[model samples]
Target chain A: MDAVLEADGLGKRYGNRWALRDCTFSLPEGQVAALVGPNGAGKSTLLHLAVGLLRPDDGSVRVLGQQPYDNVAVLPDLGFVAQDTPLYRDFTAAELVTMGGKLNRARWDASVARNRLAQLGIAPHQRVGTLSGGQRAQVALALALSKRPRLLLLDEPVASLDPLARHEFLQALMGSVAETGTTVLLSSHLLSDLERVCDHLVLLETAKVRLTGSVDDLLGTHRQLIGARHDGSAIPGVAAVIRESHTDRQSTLLVRVDGWVDETRWTSTEVGLEDLILGYLGDHRRQGSHAAWGVTA
Target chain B: MVIEFVLDGRSKVNTYMQLVQQVRQALRVGLLESGDQLPKVRDVAQALAINPNTVLKAYRQLEMEGLAEGRPGVGTFVTGTLAGASLMHQAELRADLVGWLRRAQTAGLTADDIVALVDTTIRATLADDVIVVTHT
Candidate 1:
């Protein structure tokens, strides 16, 4: 599979403090990948680096196998919607799309923008500033979709919207994905929302890549086990212990199983996507700097 | 397609499995018939706001089960009818089940409790080399 985005040893900082460090992940083309982490986990920083809004302070970042910074050649194929769905507040939807057409002349289709807004009941003449948050977000998404880009990077596009708005936004996004087979890497905190549209997962914690893989593969590899209290360090077939809790006579562990688990001795059950992610995040908090856990999905 | 799937986000069932089960249920109830087209993959994905691949996976599984067939350049169609002999007794069984559900509800079982009880009983009943007769 072709990599839509790639970063290696990526690092960034504000003044003396590093916002992101040692970050690395490759998102394959045509995969809707969920980029998740707590606030200040460098999700926005990583997205900026990929979208070429800012250059990395160290190492490298690539989009469509090319350095994205100042690369006009890649711009036509890449679409980005920054946080808060940024748009010129003064411009009407009509004028904004016309401007979008001029700026993205490579393959811009104005009808894609027009039709979407029309269906969404967002008037073309309505100034962006007067539109509700959801409407403005839709306009931004429509403009991005009109570019007909092969890749889209959305940074918390639906973070502020209500539930219905969020659903509508995702519906439009998924529709575009189905129609064009566009590769997307969107950052969001809504795991349930992500669970549906995202096939790939990239977890960032404390400025590092905690886990990233196809959701199906990750789910298959992780399990929750309960049994008599025992330190999880030497468990056979367990690739990594993500989280563990012990009582006087019992222990519960979430593990990444690389081989077969002895089902006869311990009760092993499947881990849902939410459980798998929370386990990793909790494990990271406890281990801090020197995480011995297997960091890959 | 006559049936439109509604997803329960909180359900423990996998999304694709839910889709497969919905289609099977539709078949058993005569909602979907032979030669009826399944909703297009893009339509279902867009409607449900889910990944297109998820819809494709469900369709693929349906095809694997001989319940559906895909035509190149055309849409998937219902190829197998699960309205078998057992389907004739479906109404009778449904009424009996409904009565039991009402009693269970009055007996103070919450939805989750009822689901757990039924699921455990099903597993215990279906244990060992029993026949797969409860196919619907």
Candidate 2:
């Protein structure tokens, strides 16, 4: 299956520091995938590369089966909505959506845009700056939807909306994608939203892909085993210890083991998405202990 | 058609799941039954001040679980059954209970304590009158 978006050895640098380094992942067509990372983990950089907004210092990116930079063909089929949701502050919601139609070659239906805006309860004539944060997000979404693109890229699209509006926007976005079979790459800080909407995930930390796979597979492979640490030398095959809670009698460990736990060795338990993220972040912290301790390498 | 929904800000559950669970709870309590039409995704989004996507997700989950169906030209409506199987409904619920039991075990709660908690909670909930808000 051809990926709607693919990154090959993607890296970005600013001066001597790498915002993102050696990152590579691909998003399949017609599926929703999320890029998750802490601040400055290069989620934006990766998103930019995916959308062709920024060229990578190393490697390449393909959007809709073609290179994104200077590629007009991909532009018509892809819609990139940035985190800030850039808009003409002076223009009304309707006016800005109309302007988008004029600026982009992709055919946009004015009535559809109007209906979507009205559905969001955002007045079409209301100035962009005058709308509430949630309403502004709705207008931005309306603009993206109006484009009728086959591939949708959203960065922190629901960051500013209230709980209710966030749900509404995501539902509409999902429905639109479902209806058009649009491949969507959405980045958000909220894991629960992604959990509900996305089947695939890319876990990023330290400017690299820490783990990438379907959510089910990732969860299936990682588990927490509670048992007595009988011997101090080593726990046979546990690759890394995420966390440990112990007493004189029993020791429980959260480990990222490659295989299943033998029931006799320890009681195995499933870990939630949040637990996985905590473990991944803990790994990054341990690996970067030098930076934490302020040692300039 | 007017779409009615209830928002509970107190629950620890994520807002999106809370909304979906509320719709499901409503269904369980007979507030929304088969053939009942849901409000437009946007309307519920706007009225509740949530992102449309979140509501869409709830609706999507509802649709996936067979609680709702989305008709492209018209709108989403309550479905006849949850995914499938009328006879296995109680069995599925029991499986969910077992999953919760495992979680409770992880938390160091005994089976007796779990049963007591459930009984008490069920009794308390049965004591309260249903709160239904109809919006047009």
State the DockQ of every prediction: 0.66, 0.07
Tens-digit lDDT track for model 2 on A26-144? 87776677788888888888888877878789888888778887777788777788997878899988789779879875677667678888877777788999987777777787788
lDDT of 1 by residue, A1-297 (tens): 489888899999999988889988888888999999989889999999888888889989988888888878889988999999989999999999999988988899999999999998888788999998988888999999999988899999899999998999999998889888999999999888998899999999888889999999999999999998986558889988888999999999999999998888789999888888888998746534444564643
Give the best candidate by DockQ: 1
Model 2: which docking level applies? incorrect
lDDT value, residue B76 of candidate 2: 90
For model 2, the chain A TM-score is 0.89
RMSD of 1: 6.4
Computed on C-alpha atoms, the DockQ of candidate 1 is 0.66
lDDT by residue for model 2 (B10-128), tens: 44465568878878776764567789888876566545544456677788989888888999978899975433345447668878989999999999988899999998787668656
